[model samples]
Target: MSTFKQGRYSRYLKPFSYLVDLSIINGAIFFFEINITNTYLFSLYISALWIIISFKNDFYEVQRYTKIVQVMTLILRQIGFFALILYTFIGVFKQPNISRLALGEYLLLVFLLVAFFKFFIFYLLNRYRAAFGGNLRNVVVIGDTEKSRQLINLFKKRLDFGYKFRKQFIIENDDFSLQKCFSYIAENKIDEIYASIAELSNKQINKLIDFADNNLKELKFIPDNKDIYAKKLKYEYYEYIPIISLRDIPLQVPINKFLKRLFDILLSLAVIVFLLSWLTPLLAILIRLESKGPIFFKQTRNGFNYSEFDCYKFRSMTPNKDAHLNQATKGDQRITILGKFIRKTSIDELPQFFNVLFGDMSVVGPRPHMVRHTNLYAEKVDKFMVRHFVKPGITGLAQVSGFRGEVETDKDIINRVKYDIFYIENWSLLLDIKITVQTFINAVKGDDKAY
Candidate 1:
C-alpha cells in the first residue's frame, strides 16, 4: 500500500484530523466567550495556526510501526508551539478582547477534545489494521544481520504495524545477487525496501535506491553498530555532506558514567584502606614463605580496546616464563601448597582492587584476557574482539555464569564471548550489582574450574 497509493488514503487522514481539531477549538471558544463577544474570527485564525503548525511538524505522517507515545508527543509539542505563538501575538498587539480565565478554559477544553478525538481515531486505526486492512505495505528485507533479523521479527510479531515481508535476501548466502533481488521483488507487490546499509556494497546500495525512487517504493537502511557498540545513531546533513553521528553508549552517558566511575573509585579505596591494607601483608608472608618470588604478581593483560595494562594478583604459582602464555591447569605442579589454596578461594585476585582504583579495570565487566589469549581468540571467534569495547574486570557475567576457567574447547570461549557481549550490550547499574553479588556467591561456593 505504501508504494501503490504513495500514502494516498493515509495522507487524507491528516486533513480530516486537522478539520476535527478546528471544529473542537471553535466550539470551545463559541461556548466560553463571555468578554470576547467576537470570537468567530479569532477561532478561525487560531484554527489556521493549528493546522499550519501540524503540517510544519509532519504530525499527520502515517507510520505503521510508530509507537503511541510518539503520537502523544507530537500533539503535545504542536500545542506548545501554538500556545507560544498565540501568547506572543496577543501580547505584542495588545488584544484585550479575551477573558483570561475563560480563554484558559477554552484552550484546555480544546486540548482535551482533540486528545480524545486523536486517541479514539488511533484505536479505530489499530483495529482497522488488525483486521488485515488493505493499508498493509509489502516489504522485502535484504541482508542477514542482527538488525535486519530483528526488523523482520518485529514486523511478523506486530501485524497491526501493517507490514508484510515478501522475502529476505542474504548477501552472504549461497545464491543471492542483484538480479535475484530484482526478480524476487518483481514477483511480489513490494512497497518498501529495507537493507542493512553497512553490509551492502556502494554499487548495490545505489542500485536499490535508484530502483526504489523509479518504482515509487520507500527505501530504508538499517545501520551497523555491533562493532562500535553505538547505543544511538543519528543521520543528518552537515552542510552538503551527509554524516553519521554515534551517540553515547548507556554506560558512557554523562551522569551514568560519572556515577559508575565515582562508585568504582570509592569502593576500591575502601577495600584498599580496610581489607586489602592488612590482608595483603598476611598474604605476602604466606606467598613468600613457599615461593622465592615477590608476594604480589603483576602481569600485563589485554584491557579495554585490547590495551595492555598491569593486572595485579597475589603470587599463585612459581614465577614462570609462560606466566601470560600458558593457562593454569588442574594440577600441573606449578602451584605451591599456599598458592593452590588462595587460587581456589579466589583470594589471590584481591590485589586487582588497585587495578580498579588505577582505572585499568571495572568492578564488573568481561574478565580481562591474557594478551596472548586475546590475540589467539580474536581471529578464531566471531565478535570475540567486541569484548574489548569496554573495560575488563576481575569478575564478570561470564565468570559468574560459569563460563570461567581455562578455555579447554572452542565452545568454552564461544559461550564466554556470548555472555561478555550480552553484558556489554545490556550494561546497567543494577546489572553490575547483580553480577557482583553472584560473583561473591560463586567465590564462596567454589567453582570446580577455578583451579
Candidate 2:
C-alpha cells in the first residue's frame, strides 16, 4: 500500500506542474489582448526557462524537500527573469503594439496565481496525508558512516516529506540471515530500504531484493566507489544497460567557470605586464641593495589536486633562510628590513601573478600550503586533504577572515581549513569579489598579524 502511494505521488508531480503552467498561460492570455504568435512564443520561452533554471537551482530535487517560502521565491525569480527578457525583446525590436502596462499586470497576476496554486496544492496534500496518517514512508538505512548520517539528518530535518526513519541495520557478514530481517521489515511496515552498495556483498544484495519482492517495498542503493564530493554524474545507456559516470568537474560546469578563468588570466596578465614589470625591478634593486640574495624566493607548494608546483614570492628573508619550513615569527631575525615592509603590505605576494598565469593557482581559492607543511598538517588536522579539492589561490576566505598569518598552532590550521572548506562549498563570483575587496582592505591596513 505504501509502495503504491509513493509511486503514484512521485509520478503525479510532473504532470501536475505542467497543468499549473498551462493554467497560468491561459489566465494571462484571457486577461490581456496578446497576439497569438507572441503568446505562444512567450509561453514556450517561459516554460523552457523555468525548467532549465529550476533544474540548475535544484528546485525539483526530491532530497531538497523544499518549503513554501522557498518555492514562492523561486517562482518570483523565474517570473522576474522572464519579464526582463520579454521587456528587453520588446524594446530592442521596437514592438509598439505590445501594451507594456497590460504585460506587467498579466505577469504579476500569473505569477501570484501559479505560485499560490502550487503552494496550496502541496500544503493541502500534506495536511490530508497528516490527517489520515497515510503519507509516512518507513525507511531503513544500512550503514553508519558520515554519508549515511548526512542522509539521516536530511530526512530528519525535512519532516514535510513524511519519512519515518526506521532503525539502521548493520550488515556484518555475507551470510547474514535475510529471513530474520524480512520478518522485522514486515512487522515494522518498512516501506523501503537504502543500503550502501559498496558495503554489501552479492549475497546480501540478493537477500535485500528478495525482501523487497516479498514485502512489495522499494529498495535503493547508494554507490560507494564514486567520489561523492564531486558533483559530476551522468546517466547513459550502453547496450541497453544503464550506467552512471562522472560527468565533468563542477568548476567546468558552464560559462561561469570559463569566464572566471578568463578573468583571472587577463587580470593576471595585465598585472604582470603593467604593475609587476615595474614593481619587480624596483623591488629587485631594493632587495639587492639591502642584502645579497636572489630577487625571488621559490618554494614548492601543493596546488590543485595535490600537485606540486613552485610558488614564487619576492624574497622576504635573508640568504640561506630555509631552516625547517618554519613559519615567520614576530621580530624574526632572518627577515630583511625591506622584507618586513613588503610582508606587512603583502607586496611580496605580487610575484604570484606569474604563478596564476602559469595555471599553478587561481586568484581566489584555498591558499596553498608549503609542501612540507601540507605533509605535516595532513596528519594533525582532520579532513585536511579536502582543501586540495580545488586549485590553491593567492587570496582566500581564510586570508580575508584574519586567518592569514603564521599558523603557529593546530587550532590556527584547523580554523584555516574550516574557512577554506566553507569557501569551496559556497563559491560564487560575488563571493570571490567580496573576498578580494576584503583582502585589499586588510593589505592596506597592514595588520600586525600580516607579518
Candidate 3:
C-alpha cells in the first residue's frame, strides 16, 4: 500500500474507533443506571480524554508492525486514566447520590466493551484483507542487488508489514539515468520506491525527489552503510551504530509531543517541590562533610540540538577529581564513601531537576555525554552524536535498561546509544512514565554497576 493510502485508511478507522468508544460509554452509563446532574457533560469529558490519550498513545496507528501487547497496554492506561478522572471528580464534588456500585459497573463495562470492539475490528480487518483482493501496496526497488534483495526478503517474511513487492529496477553506477526510472515508476503506478543511496547519481537523486514531488508517492532510500545522518530519516541503533531509513520520529507528532512535554514539566515540577527541595539540602550537607569541595558538581553537557548547558549533580567524588573527563571505574579512588551510596541510589542526579526547569533538558531523554567523551565516542562509534537530537535526561531508557554507570568498553557505549535512539524514535508520555517507574525500581534493587 502507498503511504498516502495507508494514512487515509488510518484516518477512516479513527472515526469508527471514536464512535465505538462513544457507544460503549453511553451503553455503560445506561446499563449502570448512573444518574447525575451533568451526565452528558461527564460522558463527553471522559470520551474526549480517551480519544486524546489514544492519539497520544498512537492506538489508531494499527499496522503490520504494530504489536498486540503495545495496543493492550495503551488501552489499559487510557482506561486507568479515565477511572482516575472519574473518581477524583466524584470525590471532590461530594456527589453522594452517585452509587459506588454503579460507577464500578460503568467503568468495568466500558473497559471490556471498548477492548472487545477494538480487537474485533482489527481482527476482522486483517482477515478481510487476507481473504479478499484488498488494497496492497505495490513497491519497486531501484537497486537489483544484495541490499535490494535483503529488503525484499524482509517484506516477504513480514507480510503483515503492508508492503507488496512489485519489481526491481537495477541502477548500476552513479552514471545511471533516472529519466527511464521515472517513466517506469509512473507507468507501473508504484506506491513506493526504495533505492540504495550509494548506487545513485546526483541526477538520479534529483529525479527520485522530483518523482515523489510530482506523483505524490513516497520514495525511501536505504543508506549504503548507515553512515550518513539525515533528520528526514529515522535511525535505530543496532548496538551502538544506527540503522538509518526513511521514517518519522514519534515525538514529532504534534499531539504526542505536546502531551509528552506537558507531562515532563508537570512531573518535574512536582518532584522538585515535593521531593527534591528538602532532599537537596540534606544531601548537600552530607557531601560537604565527606569532601572539601562544592556540594554540587556542574559540568557542560550537550542538550537538545547539540546545545551545551551546565548540568548539575550532587558532588559524588572528592575535591580535585578530574573535570576534563574520566569514567569512574569499579572501586575508583576518587569516589568517596558517601559518593558511592548516592551514586548507587541515583540520588546524585536529582539536581538536574533545575536543568529540567530551565528548559535545557527533559525529565526523561537520552543521557548527556561529557563534551570530551562525546568527541571521543563520535569517532569510536558510528552515529554517536544522533542522541543529541533530543534533550539529555537525568534518567533515560538506556539507564533503566541497565546501560548506566561506566561505559568502559566500545560495546557498552554502543548498547547505550542503541537504546537511546530507540527511545527517541518511539517516545511517548507513557514511555517516559514507564522509564521513570523502572528507574525507581532499579534504584531500590541496586545494580553492581551503579557505582
Q: Candidate 3: TM-score?
A: 0.50
For model 2 the local lDDT of residue 300 reads 89
Show the lowest summed lDDT stretch of 10 residues, model 2. Answer: 1-10
**Model 2 CA deviation exceeding 4 Å by range:** 1-171, 174-252, 321-324
Tell me the deviation in Å of residue 253 in model 1: 1.8
In model 3, the Cα lDDT at residue 226 comes to: 65
Worst 10 residues of 3 by lDDT: 1-10
In lDDT terms, how accurate is model 2?
Answer: 0.71
For candidate 1, the per-residue lDDT at 356 reads: 97
Model 1, range 194-237, lDDT digits (tens) per residue?
A: 78887889899777755553344557677665345344554532
* Deviation from truth (RMSD, Å), model 1: 18.5
Model 3, 336-426: lDDT tens digits are 9999998898888888988887888888898888878876776576556567656788889998887888888888999998998899888
TM-score (all chains, Cα) for each model: 0.51, 0.51, 0.50
Candidate 3, overall lDDT?
A: 0.74
Model 2 agreement with the true structure over 17-96: per-residue lDDT tens digits: 76777667555767776443465666666566655565554444322244566677777776777677667657665667
Give the root-mean-square deviation of each candidate in angstroms: 18.5, 16.3, 14.4
Deviation (Å) of 137 in candidate 2: 37
